[model samples]
Target: MPPKKLSISRIRAESRVRSDDPDLNRSSSSNRARKRYRSVAAGSSSSNASRYAKRKRPPQPKLSARVLSILEDDMRETQVQNRFAPDLRAERQNVSYRPLTLTQKARRDGADFQVPTLASMCCSIVANCFDSLLPSRDNFDAAAAAAGGRSASSSTAKKPIKNSHTLKKTTSTRKRSKTRAFGAAPDSDGDQQDYVPSEDDTPATKASSRSTRSRRGAPGTASSISSPNQLLAGWTTSELHYLTRKTSEQLRLLSLAASFLLYKTLVEQAPQYLTNTIISTYFLPPILSSSAASSTASTAAKTHVWLPASIPLLSHDNSAAAFLVGHLTSAITAAREYRFTLSRATEEDIPLTVLPSRLSLAQPVSFALRSLQLHGLTRLQDATLARLFEAAEPGPQQQSILRLDTISLRGCIAIADRTVTAICRSTGSTLRYLNLDHTDITANSVSTIMTSSPDLQTLKLGYNEHLSD
Candidate 1:
């Protein structure tokens, strides 16, 4: 088969027809321009046109003037109604439009549509139930009559006699009796019931009843009628006197019990009955007392008060317990008269020794050092003595050992010059007597004591191997 060949004249006519079409000419020119631009962009270094070419976006459809104006009005109204939004009209000439959030929309529309709270709903349900369960007035009156053996009609007379003058006199007398019953004197011990006025009562009768009610419940009467327990509920003189009679061990146990009870009852009951001051003043003296009882009945077994560390009041970070210990150490030195010592064998004339082991659990040894007026401390380490005196030193928050008359550091093998210096520095002005026998203190501590303590009249320095003449 032979293939048909197109003539040069036919090809020329087709090319002329294609070139004559306006759309084809325009598309060809656009394609040529795009290709030339890309080629030129690739040759440039500074120009990023080839890497990030600008995309030609389609033109957005224009909205009508009415639709645009309506959108603007809605945005303006939302901004104006938003309470949290600042007034941009005062800050700037042009205010930007922001879409209202769901919260804003709800707030704007919630004025007339309030959703009741859970509490209100529950209260309403309870009230409805209570009202339904309550007996009617007639039933309540019948029940009261059955319980008290007195009818309502007998208390509140309903019948009126025909004699007008006699009825008036009887009514006045009845009113006086009712007033005496309902509005008895505040000091009167008899029980009183509320008086409900009936429609038959006159305006004058109602006024008189109100006056009587007011007098019965006057403020002066409230104070006079208050329970005696209310006055003696807190730390009072009676508590102080009771505590003065108790032994040191008893005081410690009382404080522990009180602290525990206070912590337990604070959530459910009032804690005003037992406060920190009460515990410290009354219960703490026995624990803080350094002197043992001089009675013949006092034995060696009753010499020490053991404090357990396992108790939550002593172990935990309780503010009340901390306050009690801190106040004993800083504010109050000795709540009562007592002497301090470490020996338990001598009980009559010698000061009593409160076991340091017991004290370490409830409070620091510093509290004893601060509280002791006549100290006979012994067998204590040098570091322990130094730390105790250091804490007792005067500072911005607390005072040093006040009115310290005497101190004995006998048999303290570890007592050094530093501890003696600290002691003298803290209580030098009040220190009248000091004993440093059988200690490690040298002539240097003696010189320090002589210079620091001006009021010192008696000084004992014996068996000190370090002391040189």
Candidate 2:
């Protein structure tokens, strides 16, 4: 029939076969190949990633029931033991605590073994006297009450109730009195002007008025009678008699302690007390005597009073040395007869120039030194030594009056021929002992010393490298 109506299925099957052929469907085949390649590449990448990835850790095994029960039992036993344990915090805290009975026993034992010295007894008596002399709380209260009562009575007596007319008259009279008191000139009308005080007038008038008010207000005030002497006025005559009855030695000790306390406590407040003749005569003697004693104990006792033992070795750099030298010079001047030894246990270098200058004394330092130990003056110079030797006031004969019985220059490395020569020339007549140890002095200086110092009993030239026979 009609050239053959092609069936739809037959047509579709032929088209599909054609499409499968590579020649007929080149673009589709290329796409299919690309997809296959991409799939392969993705698979390879996944495999590679899996191979290189970090491995997870294996799970830990669970505890067995028996082990768990054992741990629980152990924990329970620890908890029970902790609960039953004694609370020792308080007991431990009291480890160092001593009972009253034990403390008393220890104190009694110490007292029984301890033997008090005369010095200790004297000190205790003096301390007791000082304590007794001091104003007590009750005395202060009584003084305050007396002062208040006096002020109140004086105020009441001075200020009486007055009528308005009388008050006006009083005020006018007061203004006239103030004008007269301030030396203010009256006006041409003969009436005192308003009198406004200047700054200078105000201060003086205020001071005078305050003083007058104080005198009128409270004559028995503590401030009016609180001086040291006034404070001592309250002491019974028997106490004064007891003090006067003390032996001279006891008096001297008391004076020494009193002076020391005064100087130590009130040096800044009242330095004029240091210049008191009574203090100089009584207080300085003991100090000078104590300082003169060559014994170690005596030296140690007086060391802290003037020269503290804690002074640094480099004394030249320390202002404390200057302060000490100044005070020492004054002390020497105060007690001239007593021969003192100026010894530095630490072997510090003292500036010889400071001695002659007398920084603290109005006059030059004058003393006949028994011993002058300049043991560690490494930087001491010849000129300084000469100046020190010539420090004394010249006598009528124009000769040095300085008398040094002993001069120790040990470890003074700066000493040279000039220094030795100067020392021999200045102090040669009186110099009994001279130490030139560890110095730069030569044989020539030694010869000069021998020629000059005929009475030299001791000459120490050891460790002088420049010295030769």
Candidate 3:
């Protein structure tokens, strides 16, 4: 059915007619209002029904005492673990080890535009940091005008002054105050007043008393810098430091001389080690001074004036002989170069008896003295011997001690049989005096030497306990 369309003019004419007829018009309007109400109610009801239908849920398990009890038990277990065994728990969801805080910004005035901004705060922080590194202005403009604008900011910041000038003043004043507060003033009689020390004694008094006690050779203070090297006995740091700066040759000669003095001191100290007739006769000085002071004064002699710095006496490890050989070789070279013969060189110029290479004296090849002048340094192992004969090659002078016709290791120890055998093998015929007195050499060594050197004129094996009777 194609509905008929009413013309606007016809509708308007009908509306006018209706207005003229009041009762008909009222009835028609009432009908229209009722129809509108019905349509609105129907639409609203349909929409609400669809909404409720979407919201409705399936039946759920009601809240029960058992579920509540279980929840409470689980919570208690977690609480117990957190209290006692915290390590057992899992980490938080969004966990971090660092303590993070929210970014904060402050509003200054009623208008946020006039508020202190982040840029201003940052600038202030930067300025503060810059000011910390530099000296603060003493007479800062205190009357910084508080202008109506936010830019007018006058901050007065200070910390306990730690500048050099302030520190010096404070320290000086503190010391003066301490002295005045602690020390007793002189009485009217001009007699020194002794302030009896009590529990309330000040730090200044304690420090003064400690210094006095140190001067008096306090128990723990004395022997604080003693070295294990018995050679550096009574040596001061100032003297050692001074000597270390000298030329190598000077150092070698001076150190050797100093060692010789110290060695003599060690002997005179009445060493518990067994002494021999050879040592007593040749090595020890006629008037052996036992005191350490006498040894120190050995440098006071006019001859040692070349050594401007005080000599430091120090001994080293098992290779003390090896160390001595280096210095001795250099010392000999220096003495030969320089016209002056050191006391050490003079003392060492006895004969080609011991390792005469230890001395600056040039040993004549024609001589043969079997007696050895071992300086009781049993620590002289094969290496020490190697260092002694390092300069002298294996051609002809290799057999004889220090390229001399004689060899003596009297009162020496730790000389192995093989060491002696090697030496015997090297020497063809120039060998004459092979003195192995009171040495650590065995019978096998003596046999090897006899076999090796058939024409050995003198083989003084006296006091050699290693040989069979």
Candidate 4:
């Protein structure tokens, strides 16, 4: 193919014509200026323009690469070790202990003593057995001996007298005449049932009657005596002591059983009874205490009681078990020094149980908690205040509230560490509502509590000058 050469004169003539047109010259100069401005702007400190010109890539950490490689090796070793490690199931089972039962308590209460069990033996157990002011077995036995030479079985002695009356009433006219001469009231039902005196006699009156009857040696006109077991039901100083001893062991067992039963019942039952405070204050304390922690299974039975951990730790059954938890909470509240004594009278006499000795403080806390439900604040002494909080059940998730609102804590009141911990852990989540106002909790304790419970709603740290967190 033939190629044609362009003349230099032709290109020069076209450049001259373009340069002569004013708009074309202006547009060429303007376009050149725009290119220059864009180049300057791209090099400037404005991040968007610079980013568009040069893309940034993150720098890889030099140490991270090596560390990850080492971690991978360690993980492989861990997996291998885990395959040969001792079974967690075995270790956990070995550590597991069964709680003590309340069977012996019911048996002891129902015992029919044949040979005299020395009052000293019974009294020794009675001394620290309970956390209440119940009476001792010695006092009961003494009262029994003083009443008559009879025992708890003595009421049955009159059964033969009743039988004789029955036989006599069924006999001929001679028997009827004999019954009339004895001034026997006509058997109203005609079944010939013997008349029995009521056993609910006042202690002093009953004692006086016994003395008078003993001196006179005259048999009572009534042929039947009510069962003596009914007479033993009331609380005397002696009976109180005995009941205190018996109830301690029994109550502990029953409480554990109730907790176990609570687990099974929670599925089918409405969550009603088990409260966060009850589990912490009543059930968990002894388990965590040095006393229970240090003791062996055998010693645990003697020293403390066992609760079946198999069931859900908390139960919401509104049954008697729930009432039991309530009683326990009340007992813990009543166990304050000031509650027991307005002035110093007794020191060693303070009863020590898993629960409190006095049940009276419950009334005040119950009233206070009710007031809190309506008024959001209830004024109470530290002891009662502590109890009201203890009685309040946890939330739906079993979370308890940390309550210190409007409480006056005197030096006489004592709260345990376990209780404080329970409050801290349970109240951590929505803690902004806390009212530690006027509580004597120190700064150090408050800080410790805050470390556990991070979300605090309202904490009165002013009076607690010692606290700082």
In order of lDDT, best first, we have 2, 1, 3, 4
Whichever of 1 and 3 has more lDDT, that candidate is: 1
Candidate 3 residue-wise lDDT, 375-396, digit = tens = 3333355444533334232435
Predicted structure 3: lDDT: 0.40
**TM-score of predicted model 3?**
0.29
Off by over 4 Å in 1: 1-379, 396-401
Candidate 4's TM-score reads: 0.20
lDDT of 1 by residue, 346-419 (tens): 35443334343333223322323222321112223455455545655665653453346677654444567777
Which runs of model 2 end up more than 4 angstroms from their true locations? 1-310, 313-366, 393-399
State the displacement of the C-alpha of residue 339, model 4, in Å, after optimal TM-score superposition.
36
Give a tens-digit lDDT track for model 2, residues 1-469.
Answer: 5698889999988876745557776657778999999999999999888876756444433433432343357454233222322123334565876545546766878756555456654544544444233343444454555567677988898676677766653222233323244454554323435544454467677567766666666857565545334444445444544544453234344433454554343332222223223323333322344333332112111212322111222222323333333444454433333222232311455565533222222222234345555444333444445444433434365445355668776654455665566566666888788877666666888789889888989888876666665
TM-score versus the correct structure, for each prediction:
0.25, 0.29, 0.29, 0.20
Task: In angstroms, give how far residue 228 of model 4 lies from its true place.
Answer: 14
Q: Model 4: runs farther than 4 Å from truth? A: 1-141, 144-230, 233-250, 253-452, 455-469
Cα misplacement distance, residue 439 of candidate 1 (Å): 0.3
- Model 2 TM-score, all chains together: 0.29
Quote the positional error of residue 250 for candidate 4 in Å.
Answer: 5.1
Ranking 1 against 4 by lDDT, winner: 1
